[model samples]
Target chain A: MPNRARFIVQIILLFLITLHARPPAAHEAPPSVRAELPLLTAPAISREGYFTLQLQSLPTVPLVVEYSTDPQFTQVTAQYPWFADFSQMTLSGFPNGQHYFRLAQAGVDGSAPNQVGPVVMVRVQHYPLNLAIGLLCFGGAMFGLLVVMIVRGHWSRSRYE
Target chain B: MSEPISYALPTSLGVALIIAFGILWIFYGWYLGRKNQTHDDFALAGRQVGLALAMATAMATWVTSNTTLVAPQLAYQLGIWGMVGYSFAALGLILFAPLAARIKQLMPMGYTSGDFIRLRFGRAAWWPFIVISLIYALGWLVSLGMAGGILLQALTGLDYHIGMSVILFICVGYTLFGGLRAVIATDFIQTVVIIIGVVVTAWFLIDKVSLASIHQNLSDNHPKLLDLLFPAALMFLFNNIFFGLGEIFHSNVWWSRAQAFRKGIAFKAFLIGGLLWLPIPIVTGFIALAAPQLGIYPPSADMIGPMVTAQVLGKVGAVIVLVVVFSALASSLDSLLAATSDLITRDIYCQFFNPEANDQQLIRWNRLCLIGLGVFTWLLCLPQVATLAALLHFTGAFVASTIFPIVLGLYHPKLSGRTATLAMIAGSTLGLISYFVVGFYVAALTSSVVSMLVCVLGLRWSTTSFRWQQLQESDGC
Candidate 1:
């Protein structure tokens, strides 16, 4: 029991090098909330397919907008806006399927993360082929069983002689 | 020194150790070849394998290249459940004990499970069974070959092609010379090394990183990783159980081991192996919590477990990780060699090519086939391009997807071999579609279900029912 307890403790301390990769403990401040800031108070869009993103920030605090199909930070928009009407903003720039958007509230002093929102998982539906051959297999089995039965019965009848 | 236990080995030393170990492993075969006893000595060690060794080999083989490489990949990204899902698959072996015992009773002197398929089902079914086993054997060879290459790239600075070719060539050389003796003896040694290495890494890692810390860190930063009740996690676990059960039940690898055992040992080994194997993936996966915090993102699924070891423990730590992986890779590769060679020699050669061949002639042919298969896989492994998991999963899916035919064929003697074959053809093709259409994980489940349905329905149409007790004692040819 003591060894098991010691074993458990040692593992935790080793894993402590990267805390956020796991769930937050009772005492720890959630990293999600630590990322919150006033200058970059961008309203996170809830439903990714069709939802308006609202931005709330000081006029002096210029916000840079970005969107991407991936959760990664490769998609930054050139256009700056105090408040860009997302209805006019082209959603077409984003890929056809689910995407992520990040808004940065920035001052000239520093461009650090004011805040980050939830990571969204989206499934895109594209119609194509799936398991159709599986259906064909069912058809084939019926045919084979039919023949096996025919042969088995003939063999049985001959054996009766 | 203050790092995690998994990080104790250096990367350079790790790679060198793996290469050194492979060279040493061949000698076991060379030795086995010198003792040219009867078929008993070659195939089953005259039924002399100890409980401990038997237990270890059974567990080691079931663990597979996938257990070390693929399980952690799924665990890291798909979250904890991916690892859990795989670990849960061990239940398949446990459930299969009854079947194993029945087989032992049916074929006390069986050479391979192919024997059971041949005698009860007759020649009409033998060819179809052979074809299924053929696809499985060759496909397994290629996947393990691919795994060896990936392990090389991870452990050493070696190119994928070189690493893979080296491993395959070495495995083939010994397997051709030694037959089942080489495979099982080496499996025993590999199992010992693997246990020591894995137990140390997992134990040390667990001691270093507490369960409490993992829960705390994941909840605070990446809550997704800690969600044990995640929906995908739930589906993944159940689907994997069925997938695993069907695969182990139907395949010649387990079948050959069962045939090689004393009448009772096969069942005992499987039950014990299943229990022992249940914890390995979970222990290794807990290390992945360091991925995000350490800024170590795995390039591919196969790299996650070792990469984490390096990030947390540094170069020396990574080397210990390498030794564990080497053990896993060898254990799985040797099983593929022995089982595939058995399939070719017994099913195709003796049954179809030359039925008049004596035991001595056929045993010689088995050794030759072992060499041929080894060479074939070695050549295939020379060009390494695909991710480790993809190579195995896709190929494994090709064979694993056919589990339905073997299972249904065995239990319900009325099921037409035609139905089993066609269902397999259907299952494999459709399984490929599912892999591309949905995802790799779901494809396995879909194929099993599709094949089972065809088997069940086809049996209903047959006029004669099967008697379970009438099974044959003859195995192979």
Candidate 2:
């Protein structure tokens, strides 16, 4: 009877170890745990290369964000470690293109796995260069005219004063 | 996250510093207040400010929270053009030098820019002008208040509300006690602190990180920042210039300065002030370009300046940033409080409610108005609406519209009051439309163009010639 009880206890302990030993998968997480995964949201379009990425909630663990050209994130272009406990991050200096991003839990050694959240897309479209140049010329002309007006006005007014 | 970003300075230290500065400034204000014997002395520093004080006040006021905070923000957001574009704001002071001379000559007794608009144009123009001035003043006050909160919170983790209220209270206390006299005297001291702090911080940043590495990192990561022909930045350049011009041309802040300086001092002081102020934004701005290399990403763009400084220099950096930002905030906040109150007291209260008010009565009204303005500004700043740059640029539409009208009214005799009124209205309407329709980069430009067109047409068609003598109201109307 004692041998039988020990066998049962060992089986239970083995079962618990097996359950806890499996590596955590972001998608395979239980429904309740998955529901707490942080969501990443970004503007649909960015006129400038820079745009802000907002997380739905504060990250409880260290997180790194990976970006790719494709939604599947097959080939990660870059990874940025979210340094602080901030819900929002302003990323700048991207060349114009469509980018896909996803958040993942960073391991103790800085390896990012257990990807969380849905993939987000941001399309970067810069303003037309010609329009910018045209505005610049127009502005320069106006500025010059203003300078002349002020200098002349000052000079002319000074003689009388 | 790696240890949750900790502030370099503790909250207790920040609170203690604020208390110390607050007491010192309030005491100094009381000391200066003893000399204010009349309304003019309270409102315009007796119109006796010498060149040294005049230059220092002008430079210090221009080196506002905008310079310390928004300049770096723009550089971070808009790249090379941002700092360069912001430095263009000095042109406002430079151009206003001539206008300052003209202003001093035209209305020797002028108390506010609204006074000039009312006497130069009629009631029609005065209404819109006053509305624009008040809105800009309030916007500036709220921005300054917001900057103070942001500065303290970024460095010391202080509550935003507490930091903001302390700054506003300190500024209002000083301006209320000593009026323009206290504002100017404090401004001189603040200017010294700001210059020394900013230079030291920049010097340390350069020592810690080589410019080549910063340049290389930006080139690799943020290539657009290096692009000379960046679209949004290009558009922002001209828009910012006009915004600065509008801000200086129409604001009671600059007008009161013009009125305060001694007769021979106005032009030179502004000129010297502008030249001195020209390079400050560049110094403040370049530090932000180094942010990414240091792996410091501010949750908000406006905090980048102080964050970068703190990240590089640690606790000492925090102390320097706090003191410099406090000085920058106080210099401009006190000036705005004193100037705006003068506008309300003289233009609105005296003109509308009681023209028969004596010097003592006017002084009392000005102090009350100062408190009211401070309270109203605090209420507005509580919500912390929009980024500092956005809040500042929104007023560009309203103020930019006044540029041509003010210029024409001062120089061109053919521009009548009705035409000037139409110009301001049309300019402001179109500018606001553009602000919503296109982007912030076009608002001021659109306003300036439209207003100039209206003024040109007015000059061509109008036969009315305004006599400059009408501005010299003996009863201080």
Candidate 3:
């Protein structure tokens, strides 16, 4: 059973990698952040590939996130806009590699160029193939039991008649 | 304050729709009431409901707003196990199928579940059973009422108080006119609406966001959600099963339905209802998984399902979600109102207040009970004390304690009244302590285990062999 489980895990991982294979797309953060609001800490990376960006900014000022693979930062890989009570943003969809993220705010009415914050580096992890297989096995067993119960119930009813 | 989220429907339109549906349902109930010649007819639908309506009402009442709203919230909070765990709740209905058959054979003339408790265990057990039943029923009612208001406000930006009041008024009005017959009949239509609306929303969601993408996204970002070995989620899986069993086994809601369904139909109807309901939480829970991918973050997790549907499908989806939620809420609110009122009328009023009360007086009292319960529920909902899930589970400690007593009492005659009473009190007290100390996830689990142990002890020592024939006694008799 363990051998079969290992094979299943390998197959799922291969399937996921193939499905997620995509042409290189630009992922970058917008340039510049208003200096008044400073980022409290660098974006923290979780085991799950989510990048949590925490900043000390006024609620009124909308924040934008910029990411880039290039250290010179000429090309932007991804951009996300954040607007809500919490000065925190959780970003996903970054491929498994080291990437740079920075917070920025576009000046109102283009009055000033984009204000940029300090850049932070984070790394995304490999897919959780083992967890996926375990979840599927559990779900499959449950549904299988349900089907058996239904058939048995109906079967018993017919015989009693 | 930040502006409330936008919705497709106008507030006036939503209000008008509720009022219109309310008036129509009440009139329909009055029409059905014309056939209600006796109190039994009113309360049990003359115990002649056929296969189709029986199955529909059973499935619809069990759906509740929880199936639509909380299933998604659970999925969002607990991951894959959350939804799969929720779908297991259908086991309650499936398991109850045979029990329903037994209930009908034992008490053909029974009025409520209280009747069974009183006959089996005497007054000592009956009192705590009533308190537990009342608390569970009222908790469910207030939660359903609050869900309606929250749904309308979420979808159409309507005032919470107005939306909440309107739903209560509508359910109370119809139930006041028709009783169980009305509740069942409305449940049939509501079931169709709920099924069609949810299927449509789910279909559109799948088309907009493929399951592959949803799977890959969760696997990528929210790996814990897909983690089968998640500790909290594992605890919730068993706790929810116990809670569902306790709710169905002990509450008058399912008891009344069992009594109302035609003789042979009760078992099959519940079986079929459980089957029909098994897939719903899966469909609903899938929507919440798409929430993170869609970049839609609701202020409250309970609101994720509706918020996601609206943002993805736009205005038309919002309308479908509103109608679906409305139907689900009404189906449950109306059933709780009808069943709980029957308990009050038969157990409290007829048994204690006036033993000489005739069928006409009892029927009138049932209608009045519905209105009074509705008002009380509305007032409780006004405070918005807790989230729907929290409020429902708070009573979990109380209801979960009844599982062992009820199952043992139904099957094993050796279970004594003293043992049953002590089990409930000890189980509930300890369960509440666990809920405060450990967490909500283990409240039902601990309560069920404690209750089971006490019941087994009673079974060992007690020598009484209860005669099933005694269950035929009328309350006043």
Ranking by TM-score: 2, 3, 1
| TM-score per candidate for chain A alone | 0.29, 0.71, 0.58
| Residue-wise C-alpha lDDT for candidate 1, range B58-93, written one tens digit per residue | 888877777877777667655777777778778767
> Each candidate: RMSD to true structure?
13.4, 12.4, 13.5
Among residues 3 or more apart in sequence or in different chains, the pairs in candidate 2 whose N, CA or C atoms overlap within 3 Å are none
Fnat per candidate: 0.00, 0.42, 0.01
Candidate 1 chain B least-lDDT 10 residues: B1-10
Q: Which model scores highest in lDDT? A: 2
**lDDT per residue as tens, model 3, B305-385:** 887898789878887888888889989998999999999998999889998999999998988998899989999999888
How much is B204 displaced in model 1, in angstroms? 2.5
Candidate 3 residue-wise lDDT at B48: 91
* Rank list by DockQ: 2, 3, 1
Assign candidate 1 its CAPRI class. incorrect
lDDT on C-alpha atoms for all candidate structures: 0.59, 0.86, 0.77
Residues B1-477 of candidate 2 have per-residue lDDT tens digits of 232344667776776787678878988998999999999999999999999999999999999999999999999888899989999999999999999999999989778888888888888999999998998999999999999988887777666777888788879988989999999999999999999999999899999999999999889777888888889999999999999999999999999999999997899999999999999999999898998888777777898899889989998998999999899999999999999999999888998899889999999999999999999999999998788999999999989999889987888777898988998889989999999999899999999999989888888988888888988965443
The clash count of every prediction, one per candidate, is 33, 0, 14
Per-residue lDDT tens digits for candidate 3, residues A18-106, read: 22222111112222334454573554454434445666653345455666877566886555554333445545334456778776663
